[model samples]
Every structure is written in structure tokens, then in C-alpha cells.
Target chain A: MSYLAFQLKKVFKNKLTPVCLAILLLLMGTVLFMNVRTNPQFSLQAGAKSEIAYRQKEINRQQRLLKHDKQKSKTEVYHDTKAAIKQNQDAVKQDKQVQKAANKGNWRKAYTIMWQQKKQEQTISSNGQDLAGINSRINVEKKLQFFNYLHHEPLPYESQDMPVTGWQFLLQLNQQYLPYVFTLVALFLLTLLLTDSYHQKLDTAQLLPLEKNNLMISNTIAGIVLTLGSFLAINLVLFIVASLIYGTGSLAFPYIVGQYTGGRPLIECISTGSFIIKVIVLQVLTFIFEVVLVQFLARIFRDKLPALLIAILLVPGLNIATMIVEPLRKICAWLPMTYLNAVDIVSGNLGMNYQNVQLNYTSGLLTLCCSILIITIMILLSSYIKYKE
Target chain B: MLTVQNLSLKTRQPILHDFSYQFAPGQFYQIAAENGSGKTSFLRAVTDLIPASSGKVLLDGKPYAKNKRKLFFFESNEWLNVNLTSLDYLKFVKRQWHSNVDLDQELDLLGVREYVKVPIKKYSLGMKQKLIVAMYLVSGAEYYLMDEITNGLDEESRAILYERLNNEVTQRNKCIILTSHYSSEIKVNNLHRLVLHKQKMHEVKQ
Candidate 1:
């Protein structure tokens, strides 16, 4: 049998592997059910409709006042009210057209109209409710556009019952919990598989009819296979389970990427499908890089526990390190650990809350690639020297 | 045949200095040394487990790189995983050497037949030692390097190991290099002894 197959079989036999797998599924299931319960899918469509209804009622009231014989002379409040009524009427007329276009599956046009509506709303007032209404219009229109892009249909919106999208639920679940789950799997299950050669005295492996490089490469491949396999499998399972319950949401939905500015919050969004894909790719790269790292540390320490602890702690440690250490903060974009928190890293919001060090997807990908290259070289060199002696 | 020329090893200090030896088929050598006197380092240096400061080791006049599969080295039971059963470890070693040796027969011979399926962690030190010896014996390699693996075995187990060592050297015509602090425990006839003192070997008359 191939070495990778052998290693995989060995990994399967490990008690930790099964335990960690069970934990992963349980954690995902719990998070899915909990996120479904709370964060009750806020209705963007409802917010917009309410705004329109409010404006129309205000317009009717102002028209009635203009016709009534209450006072001949108009006060400043009355004139302001009259102007507001006209603006509201025009805004409502434009939004109705946008809604009509949206219902006809023209989400992009709807989004454009909502953006204009927001600009119009901003010009009139910065009142929180008005801001929220405009924001809702844009957000809902974008979701509808995404729904169309993903499934090629007008978005079927939720009313009081707020229908939760399965894909959206899974995506939210992943954004918050995947990193921790990935870390646990890496630390508890995968690290031991790699480090056991030194720690548990599996050194008898040296006598295997394979060369040192082949042995190390085979082990690394086995690790990648397991790590990537478990990560994808967990996601796939959650997707199916969630889809069955909540209905698969649009992949084209906007992901709310957040950044902090001087104690204030800023939010923007990108395509959900691309966002999820980017995260998965980066996270897989991170697992491979971490596998190499653990192997390297095993070679140095010649013990599993130390290597395991170091590899597991290194990710979050680096994230915090970038905060306290200015130099590390500056170069965090080039550091592999910065990419471990995939959601934040991909959105350039990794250290926004703490240090404001922006990390883009491209930089995170490039940095992780460089780390993999360097670690691969180190592993090969170590194996060669080991065999050469 | 195995040959070592000008072998020296150092880790911060000279662990072994200019050590050298040769062994033909059908020979077993017991290398003895005081603790920290470089006996383990010498065997490790010979097997390329650890790098030599200066020297070359050859199996049949070819360096270890060429005939690595024919040279078997085990440092005590360091390669044994306690989580694995005796039978599993035997199969693992058998695979490493690409052999068809029946692991159960080896286990029976080593007196671990009753506990072959039990985890090594549950076994006594002597049982663990016997299993290690059984594993190495099944390797069928032309040259065997053992580093102080028989330390905890009982007299019966040690005798079994000695008899197997004799068979490998006499019947199979394989070379065996083993290390021990108590050289008297080795009962193989026609034996050769190398004592390490202060980083050098002194050949003792057999």
C-alpha cells in the first residue's frame, strides 16, 4: 500500500481522531441550531416597506393640512413640513418603481435605485431611523441581487416569519466558528499523527524500506489529506443539514465586512460565494502550513507534547503578538498566522478592532504561500541531512 | 559485512573519538561502555542515526545510503509505541523490512504468546523487551545494530534473545552489533567484545 494510505489508516486507528471528529460535528450542529434560534434573520425588506409606508402617511397628512382652513399664514415648521412632504412623495414614487423592478427580477436596477434613495435620505436627515431605513433598502436590494445571481430569480423575501437561508446560516456559522474548530482538529488530532514518530517512539519507522524524504513527504501528504478532508467534510455535512432545514440561501448575498475607525464601526460587503471560497482556500493553506510547522518542531524538540502545544498556540498568539509588538504588526500581512482567522483576514479587518493593521486577501494568500514554501524547504533539508548522515 | 573507518562523534564535546571496527557475517560483537562514555553515540554514528564528525561506515563496502534496507538499528525500545499491541508492532516491523516472517511465531518464541494482542503499555518491561527483540529478529536484515535494548529483560528472556542472536550470526551468517553495560549476560559463543573508555574502544580477547 502507499505511504499516504498507510498513514491515513494509522490516523484512523488513533483514538484521538475519532474523538476530535465527533467534537467537530457536535460543535457545528450546536452552532447551527443556536445561530438559527438567535440572530433571527432580520427582515431588510420589511424595514424598507415600513419606511415607504411612513413616508406616504406623512405625505397624506401634509396634503390634508394644506387643504384645511386652520391658519392663513404658514409658520417655519409648516413650510419645513411641506418641503419634507414633497421630498417624501418623490422618494416613495422612486422606491415603488425600484420595488416593481426588483419583483420583476431586476435586482441590479433595484440596488441602484436603493443607493440613490440612500443618498437622497442622507441629504434630508441623519436621523438614525432614516439612516437605518436607507441602509435596509440597500442591504435588502443587494440580497435580492445576490439571490438572483445565485439562483437566477427575484429574492423571495421573509415577512414576519423571517425565512432563514440555509447557505446564509452555514456561512454565518463558519465565519464565527470554523477557525476554532479547525484549530482544535489541528492541535488535538492532526498534530499527534505527525509528531508521534518522535514522541511515542515510532522511530522504528526509520527502518521502512523508504528513504527519509519519501517518508517525510508521505507523512506530510497524509496530514494534508486528513486535515483538508475533515475541514471540507464538516462544512459539507453542515451545508446539507442546514439546507434541509432552512432552505439553501443565495451564494451571491453580500457578506458584511466590518472595520473599526476611532471607536466607530464601518461596514461593507462582498459576494458571499467568493468570500466563502476564499476563506476555505486560505484555511486549507493554513492547515498545510501548520502541518509542516509541527513536523519541523517535532524534529527540533523530538517530543510530541511540546510541538503540539507550540503549533496550536502559535496562531492566536501571533494575532495578539501583532498587537503588542509594533514590528510584527507592520509585517503581519506577510505572516501566515495573520491569515488563520480567515473571515477577518480576507476582509482586511483582522486587527481593525485592536491595532488597525489592515490585512487583505491577496496579502494573506501570498504570505501563506511564502510560508509553505519556506517550511517545505526546511522539511526537505532536514530529511536530507538526516538521510545523508 | 560491515565496516567503520575513522568514526568520531561530538556533541559540544568529543563523545566518540576516532572509533573504528569491522565485522564479517556470522559474528556478534558486544560493545560495552560506562554511562555517557559514547557507546550509544558510536552505534548511532555507525548507523548514520547521528552524524559523525569524521568517519565513514559501510555495509559490504557500500555506504549506509546504498544498503540502508539491509542495516537494522533500534535504540532500546525507543521505536516501540506503547499504544500499539505486540502483534501490530511486529507487523509494522515486518512491513518495514518487506518480510513474510510470521509475527505469531516470533511472539511465541519470545514468550509473549499470551499477550501478543495486548497493548505494550500494559506489558511488563521484560515483555516489552522481548517484543522488541522479536521485532528485530524478524527483520531479516544482514546487519543489526542494537543499543542497550536488553536492559530490563529477565534471565529467561535474555537467554532467548542470546540464542536468537547466535542463530542470526551462526545459521543466517548475519552480523550483530549490540551494546550492554553487563556483558556477562550475553551467552553467545565465539563472541567478540569492544569496551569503550574515555571515547575510545579497547578490544577484549574473546
Candidate 2:
């Protein structure tokens, strides 16, 4: 039998693999249940009502200031309160319109009303290059894109907040915090599998007639396959379950990826199917890099716990560091850890977040491939040196 | 022939000091040592599982590294991966050495056929011992360095093991060097007996 086959057998026979998978499935199930319970349609209605109530309260406060403050400058107070009431009244009017459309199950009309209000606000407010202005522009462009896309396609049975369709749910899960959770989980599983296959069995495996380096490489390959295979199976199950519960959503749904126009934001959109495929490709590359990294660390530390701890400190640790470190933010396009947020990169959210347009799909693919190649070379070189000595 | 020249092992104190010997094919040699005498350590040092303070082992006057597949050594059944089954281990060893030993015959001889398909973790001590013995026989290496392989074997299992080892050594021209505490229980014929005394090997006259 091939050595990889033997290693794979050993990995699957280990009880830890199944146990970790079970826990992961249970966590996903619970999160899905919670998401279904707090449906977004109801939340939108509730949110609009609250916003109208808050605006009414603010208007009442401003009216009291206009009437009771006799000692203050009367003309300035009158104009300020009048402007405040007008703004609050406009907001209240919009909120009521949104609430009415939401009740009628016509989200497209609500988005059109929102787009008109955003256009009015844009005309009144100066269009500057500030972060808030950029964000507002992006939001406006996104609303228009969604409104246009909805004109051709059927209305999304559910909002993005609580996506009922399979494709939307998958996209939502990736776009939100679930990618981070999955990355951490995959890292944890990789650490365990590598530690067991290499560090714990080094002594016994040394006695094998095969070259030590070949053994290490074979075991590493087996570990990656098992780690990826188990995750792939879990994801398949999730996709099937989600699709069965909710209708399988159209993959042609368009998402605003970025702004193509330089000075003023012109929205660039991609299909959901293409976006998801790119995300998976980038994520698989990232996962391979992580597996090699854990093996390399295990070889260096020569113990399971230290190797696992250090790997944790390196893979996800570096990802967290990039968010807080200013220098790292500027250089995120070159760093492999930045690509750990594959979904965000594909969606252009990470690029926008860092104000660095270079952290996109192409850059991420190059950076991850370079990182994996370099680390794999290092591992092989280290193994050779240790074998020779 | 497998040759050991100037091998020295030490942990806090010396275990083997410049111990040298030449093991030829078609012979069964036994090394007897008391508890804590580094019997397992010697076997480990020979396999290069533990780094020796000094010296090297050679097959046909060449470094063991060049012909690693020609020799097989497993210190004990404890080193086997408990997650794997007996068949997995047997096939692994066979492919590693590129051996042509019949796995079914070896399993039947070692009486491991009953639970060969079960994971090693669930096996009893005796069952694991049998499986290890079967692996060694199936390896078909030129030199076999075993460490107390019969520790948990029953009388029937011991008889089967001795018969197989004798045939492999005398008829097949294979070299067998094993360490054991109970030398008298080894019933193979024309066996070369050696004793570990003062961190060195000395031949014993039968």
C-alpha cells in the first residue's frame, strides 16, 4: 500500500477527527436555527418604527427649545430648531414609507424610496473624499445596483440579513463573521492532525525503513487531505440542508464588489456564483498554506503543545495583528495572512476597509501561492538537514 | 553481514561503550541482559532511532543510511499506532521493505487473524504482541533487530514464533538479533547466545 494511504487510514481511524466534525456541525445547526428565528423582514419593520419614534422625540425636544428659551438668541434658536424639525420630519416620513412598503412585501419600492432620499441628501451635502462620504457613496451605489438587479430577477424571498435561500445564506455566512470562525476551526483541526501524525509518532516512525523526509512529506500530504476532506464533506452537508429547508437561490444575483470610477463612485458588480467560486479557490489555497505552516512549526518545536500554540500564534494571530497594526494595514496586499479573509477580499470589503485597493482576488492568489511555496521549501530544507545530521 | 563498530550510547551514564559485533545471515543470535541494562537501548542505537554518542552501523561495510530498507527494527508493540489496525501495519511494513512475505500465512502463524481487522487500541497485550511479531516476519528484511518481542506471548504463540524465526534464519539465510530477559524460553536450535556485561557484549558458550 502507498504510504499516503496508510497515513490517511491512521488519520480517519483517530477518534478526534469525527469528534471535532460533530462539534462543528452542532455549532452551525444552532447558528442557523437562531438566524431563522430572528427573521430579517420582521426586524426591518420593527427597526423602522423605532427610528420614527426616535425622530419624533428629537423633534419634540427641539420644539421645546424653540418655545421655552427666552434668554437665548431668538432668531438663531428659531432657525436651528426649524432646520432640526425639518430634517427629523423628513427622516420620519421616509421611515413611514419604508414601513408601509415592508408590510406590502415590496422591498423594491422601499429601496427606490431610499435611493431617492440618498440622492437628495447627496445633493444637499458636499461630496468630499472623507471616509464617511466614501461609505455613503458605496451604500448609495449598492442600493441602486440591488434595485436594478431586482427589476430583472424575482424579489429575494428574504433579506440579506436573514437569507432564506441556499446561495444567499452561503454568501451571507462567508461575508459575515463565519469565515473567521471557520478559519480558526480549520487551523485548530490542522494543528491537531499534524501534531498527532508527526510530533507524537516521530520516534516510532524513525524506525521505518523509508527516508525520514519522505515520511514527513507523505504524512503532511495525508494530513492536508484529511483536514480538507472532512471540511468539504461538512460544507456539502450544510449546503444540502440549507437548500432543502429554503429554496435554492439563484446564483446570478449581483453584488456590488467595488467602484470602477476614480473620482466619483461607479459601482462594479459580480455574479454571486463567480464570487463564491473565487472565494473557495482563495480559501483552499489559504488552507494549504496553513497545513504546511503547522507542520513546519511542529518540526521546529519538536513537541505537540508548543507547535500547536505557536501555529495558533502565527496563522490567525497574524490575521488579527493586521487589523490593529497600521504598517501591516498598508502592506496587507503582500501578506498571506490578509488573504485569510478570502470572502472579504473577493467581495472587495477588505480592500475598502483598509483603503488599499490592492487587497483583491488577484493579489490574494499571488500572495498565498508565494507564501505556500516558500514555506514548503523551508520545511523540505529543514527535513533534509535534520536527516543528514 | 551487519557490522556494529565502536557504538557508544549514554544517558546520564554510559549504556553501551564501544560495543562491536558482526551479525551474519543464516544465524539466530540472542542477547540476554538484566532489567535496566539498556537492552532496548542497544536495539534502538543500532536502528539509529536514538543518536549514539559515537560510532556507526554498516551493512556490507557501507553506512546503514545507504541500505536502510535492508534492516528492520521495532523496539516494542507500544510504538505501533493504536489508531491503525493490524492489517494496516502489516501492509505498511511490507510495502516499506518491499517484502514478498505472505501476509495471510504470517497472520495465521502468529494467531492474529481473529482481530487483524480491528484497531490496535482495542487489542489486548498478547494480541498486540502477536501483531508486532507478524509485522516483523512480513517485513522480510535482511537483518531483524527485535527487543523483547516475546514479552507477552503465550506458550503456543512462542512455539509458532520460534519455528518461523528458525526457518527464516537457517533456510532463508536471514539474520536475527533479538534481546530478551527470559533466554531459556527461546527454544530455537543452534542459537548464538550473548550476554551484556559491563556495557559490552560477550559471547556465551552453550
Question: Which candidate tops TM-score?
Answer: 2
Off by over 4 Å in 2: A42-110, A124-158, A175-180, A197-203, A209-217, A258-268, A325-327, A356-358, B10-13
TM-score of chain B of each: 0.93, 0.95
lDDT computed for candidate 2: 0.77
Error of 1 at B97 (Å): 1.9
* Chain B fold agreement for model 2, TM-score: 0.95
RMSD of 2: 3.9
lDDT of 2 by residue, A259-288 (tens): 233544446666788888999899788878
lDDT of 1 by residue, A115-220 (tens): 6665554554434466567556544444443334434333544221233466676555555677766676776666677776662333545656787788888888
Off by over 4 Å in 1: A39-73, A78-152, A157-165, A199-208, A250-275, A309-314, A320-331, A343-365, A385-389, B12-14, B111-114
TM-score of each: 0.77, 0.86
DockQ of model 1 vs. true complex: 0.28
